[model samples]
Target: MADRLSQVSGHLTNSYGRGLLAGEVAIITGMCWRSWSGIGRSAALLFAKEGAKVVVSDLDEKKAQIVVDEIKAAGGDAIAVGGDVGADDFPQKVVDAATKKYGKINHIVNNAGFTFDRMLHTTPDDAWDVIQKIHVRAPFRLIRAAAPHMRFKVRRENRSVINVSSISGLHGNVGQANYATAKAAVVGLTKTVAKEWGGFGVRANTVAFGFVKTRLTQAKEEGASIEINGKKVALGIPGAKDDPNAQYPHIPLNRGASPDEAAAGILFLASPLASFVTGHTLEVTGGQGI
Candidate 1:
């Protein structure tokens, strides 16, 4: 069974909901349709169900709106703000919209990014730059843009910011030199922000994922693709030469994580449950590193 937090699972509409995030305003980047949708979308929806008003960002405006619509249909309040997170101006636009719509920003999830796999000596400069821009630079800019808004609410509420990393970044992986570098950079950035923002009561953390079931994990032969910065890029789990499912059997859990299951750790970091936690990297790998 999938984790309840991963599913709607009586949490959103159920009377049993903890309302863990009651009265919070959240901004989740990369939450929409297509490749970047999995974890970001689940986090957005889960946050809303916990009583947050969300501002969701995606590269595709229409795709962003689709997720926004789903939130509203479920009786939650949300809005779509779409743009390339790698762009210099896009982060500010997303932060501005969230504050304008919700009166303040309390949570930010810098989950917008994609993998560009290649060996170090063979990777193209474009691939290296694109991966870095999306994974490292984008999150840095978004957090920088959202921090000021969150500070204003620091005394009133425990503001939180969460960045998404991956197992490839943690233990390192073949054919992912670019992703591994950027994600490792994210660990440093997350810890730095935690110290800088802690005095203001803002908690910053990174949720490093193992293998979550998403288009990124699909076998290359599945022919999955995503449009990023207007270029079609291959989307897959990186090491799959044959069966994509081959990687899962090696996982300690003996299964890949559901999107919602991956998101559950993120929500905890973003919610009051992790009020004292910051500068921490919560590995959601089902003991993959062990």
Candidate 2:
């Protein structure tokens, strides 16, 4: 499955040998654990293959080290930095680590985030605050820290910022009020940062993803099979078990996207291909909302 997915990705980019991101350094957050491997790992590998050095950051040291090991085994340049995104000093720490190792920071992917399932009335205040801190506060702080570094790089080399948002933010989902609010704020941050930093050759944008198979989705699928809150809500579509294409019958594309597909969109926005693109939200949902 991994090999097949790689082939699909190679064909999708079609610029494997061009080195579009050559000499660049990208920091990817939320890249720990098997569930996040698809998007975060794929992005790290792809960036390296394109001649960019990578900084893989995650809250889980073990998982983050695994990603770094994989990249190194592939003969790519990378390092793992483990720290909680919700930490007050995490942003500065991330920037410091990236600069110390790579000597410069060029791109950032704000992807580290998760949310506990709870409806508004059922959510506790602590849970709401934690969700917001992780999803919104952390990303914004990281961008703020990276801004000056990016500016310095631009004076010497251009840079970009890719913030990961969600469809839940665009069209709210039940039991995701706090998560949605945080993600929506990310979109707003993306635009504002793009506008403020454009002159410095720093571009910012967001990627809003829909259903994608990951550890989180798998857990949700398992939980959905059993009754929750006195309701049997099917996490996955009825026929998705056998036919992957059956998952999104209502979507124009009729299927969910792979993590690599989402990563490709991030790469595009970060590359010269999107030199003039900023403050945009690229939906990697197979046309689900359209």
Candidate 3:
């Protein structure tokens, strides 16, 4: 089933031409993960297929370069920028990279983040702070860094800012108190950006995803882990039954989304197709929490 889905996604991507996002420049962060299932990587590839020059950012420099190579091999324009978004200077560096390569930024997809899940009672202070720093503070800083480019004095075209959120933010999740609070703040930040930048023809929105089959959602027993501050932080759900069908019964589709599927939602918001859509949270869950 996964292979078939990949084939279909590849076909549709190849079908895209210089139409929806032609002549646009975009910066998409978090474009790399151990597996090729990062939503940001998918978004970068999809955006490039639609004719957008992409600036792909990720903490893993080598992995990010792989995605950049893939884009260029597909006859798409892209450059890899490696940095930690949690760093104070990294956001400006991303903005600089985009402007330096593409001349200007038209779209910003704040998709660089991770999860450090723990129940409220067990959550550590540093865990909560780091989650907010990565998920909420990073986006805020990136937008602020790109404001001069996007919030132009005399705008020439429609610009977009798509912030990635989660259903956990909208409807709290177990063992995700830190994640939920940070994601909820993301919605407020996006709405404020829309309100402040609407007159400049800049649209800001959020994509609230539910379950997506990425490293973050893979079973913890798989041993996929990310290092944070010298400590190994494990990724994925604990005690997952290893059955997609049995795992997501609450979702109407009874399955988690593929990264490519989630990227489609980000593509729509960044494309001209959603010219008038702003300050909205397009939930990409399979009818979960409805």
Candidate 4:
């Protein structure tokens, strides 16, 4: 019995570990500080675990390096590229970092963004502009910058682009006018990419996430904040799920998703498992709004 169990365990490990994305190179953006368990960091680590060389990008070089170090400690290959995604020149920098180090690009995940929640009437021009720049424009620029590497290849390779969206974008949210618009634009952009890049066999998709337990979803009163464009913006809800009277009757799962869970959805879209899938908006919402 012991020998049989050992054989099964060994087979499972060998078959699964370092196989899904072997020989693939991936670039992931928006890996936040270590203190906040963001989905981008989770996806970076998970992709490395699956045998892909990873490029981790974040606003803070030290924070991105932390993720790279973790991947190395786990016997995976990774590098850190820190920059502001909203910067016009930064998207090209990210693509350059990947192509220079790995010599190719197989996957791209545009996951760097933050919400500036406010009613439509009260939302300022800067707030709207920043959100659109980060969530929509950055992804567009990155994809365009990576065109020479990903498109018009002599020998076609399986490539993918996974753009992160929000449930609010699918079914509007209060006080998220700017955020919702940006996310909705992501879906349109992804579909267009799918159509335009299909001839080259490059897949583009969007993952619209529900409530996830990241810094973005924490209690605002906790004082967690992030600086954008030389201004500080508070993060999270006030009561959130911690409120004694709060309940999650809307979500069939009855709870928010973890960063790891959200990352899994991104992984699926980037992996060869979704080779035949493109221009799809995968909703990782725990059945919410369904």
Candidate 5:
């Protein structure tokens, strides 16, 4: 009798809401930092909150462990693996470490990246190569490393890969030739991966974002930058104010999305809710890019 009453109440309202990813393990890359917290960190936190154990991969060991500690404090499961995505060995290292700890891989969110904006005339060979390696090559290798575990496994459920992109990739942005090229390349790669991996019940998709106020997009007045290898590059948009989107007169939503808001899009694609969604790009820009 009590169980029947509870069921009726649950139907009417919310019954403490079981998480959408109640039984999964996810690998999220590019999660780090003290001031420049971006979509990667937000997505990792949300995924863990949604009942998925997580592997927090980032360039900085200290910052990566910080995210893992936060997840554990919230009663969620997580571990940190620090390595440069641009390194040849890092992708496989991430996969090996994840499988050793979690036993299996269920989701891959390729969110590690940084923008090295430069005009076409001034774009150096090294600059272009770095962006491509981090944004394009890393995603390709990570997904490939995880594919063997996902494909032809009798007990495996549908697995997914979410490649993080930028609005600049969809609609070319000036002064960002290298950054834009790498991002755009991932979209094409994702579409191809979706087709080839579909037979194995694995899905591939992209999430392109507009102005979300991370250190990468914060106003220069905030003193935002990222140290790549050893060089400190100015890593943010200038003159957009603290709320980059709110200051924009053309944005449909009238404000920029918070990190959590941007993360919601990635979380959706990673969850079972998007099991049938592949080869698609979900723009979580609050209608900024149209």
Candidate 6:
């Protein structure tokens, strides 16, 4: 029995080591200091583990380099590009960097976005514009810039795009009108691109995440509630999941999703396993808002 168990463990370990994306190249945006275990950092790490050569892009050069360094330390291939996604030149720079480093870009993850918590009535015009520019305008421009390159590759190869959205966009959260509106625009953008680019062997999709532990959540105080679709959902203080108020009673899974879990979904959509899927929004919220 001991020998049999040993053999089984050995097989499992071997199977786990075979890389899923041995020769692919992935471009991940918004991988900066603000991304504390959220979509940006999680996507970068996950893509590297899958054996893809990763390109980490963010406004902060230091933060983007940190992710690249971590991937290299783990024996994975990666590089970093620093630029503002909202800039007109940023999208082209990201694509050029990825192509120069990896020879080709197989996947793109548009995950650069920020949320400012303020009631619509209290939100300043400048804040609203900035939020939309970062969340909606940036992704739209990046995808537009990357699509031609992806289409060119698709004529000779295949590619995918994974846009990160949020439950707030789907259900409409209070004090987050700016964020919700921007995310909803992402969904529309994803669908439109999927249709426009489908003929080129490229797929586009969105991942709408629920509450996850990240710097955005950290900004909120402990035991705060945000209204979703007219229902109140309590948000836990960052790093304090043990607090009873943090528990999501409406979630069928009885817990919030981890960034890794959400990242897995994005990776799947970007993988060959989801070649037939496009223009779809996959919600990774433990069945919340379903």
What is the Cα-based lDDT of residue 89 in candidate 6?
A: 92
Q: After superposition, how far is residue 9 of candidate 6 from its true place, in Å?
A: 27
Q: Please list the residue runs of candidate 2 whose C-alpha ends up more than 4 Å from where it truly belongs after superposition.
A: 1-18, 153-156, 221-245
The lDDT, on a scale of 0 to 1, for candidate 3 is 0.88
Global lDDT scores for all candidate models: 0.82, 0.78, 0.88, 0.88, 0.84, 0.78
lDDT of 4 by residue, 169-242 (tens): 99999999999999999999999999999888799999999988888888888887788878998888877765
Q: How accurate is candidate 5 locally (lDDT)?
A: 0.84
* TM-score per candidate, chains pooled: 0.88, 0.84, 0.92, 0.91, 0.91, 0.83
| Candidate 5: residue pairs that collide | none
Candidate 6 lDDT tens digits, 113-228: 66666779998776688778988888888877776568753322437888899999899998889889999999999999899888887889999988766655653455455333
How well does model 2 score by local distance difference test? Answer: 0.78
> How well does candidate 5 score on lDDT at residue 248?
62
User: Which pairs of residues clash in candidate 4, taking residues 3 or more apart in a chain or in different chains?
Assistant: none
Report the lDDT tens digits of candidate 1 across residue range 1-290. Answer: 47634343343333235487777898898864454447888988998898888998888888878888989999999999988898889988988898788888888899988777888899999899988899999888888887678665333365888989999889899889999999999999999999988888888999999977776776767778776657888878545544335555567887778889988999889876676689999999998987
Worst 10 residues of 2 by lDDT: 233-242
- Cα lDDT of candidate 1 equals 0.82
Across residues 1-290, which tens digit of lDDT does each residue of candidate 3 receive? 79855654553454354457777899999975764479999999999898889999889878788998999999999999998999999988989888887899999999998899888999999889999999999999999999999887552375899999999999999999999999999999999999999999899999999988888887888888899988888888876656645656799998888899999999999876676799999999999999
**Residue-level lDDT tens digits of model 2 in 169-205:** 9998888898889889999999998998888878898
Weakest 10 consecutive residues of candidate 3 by summed lDDT = 8-17
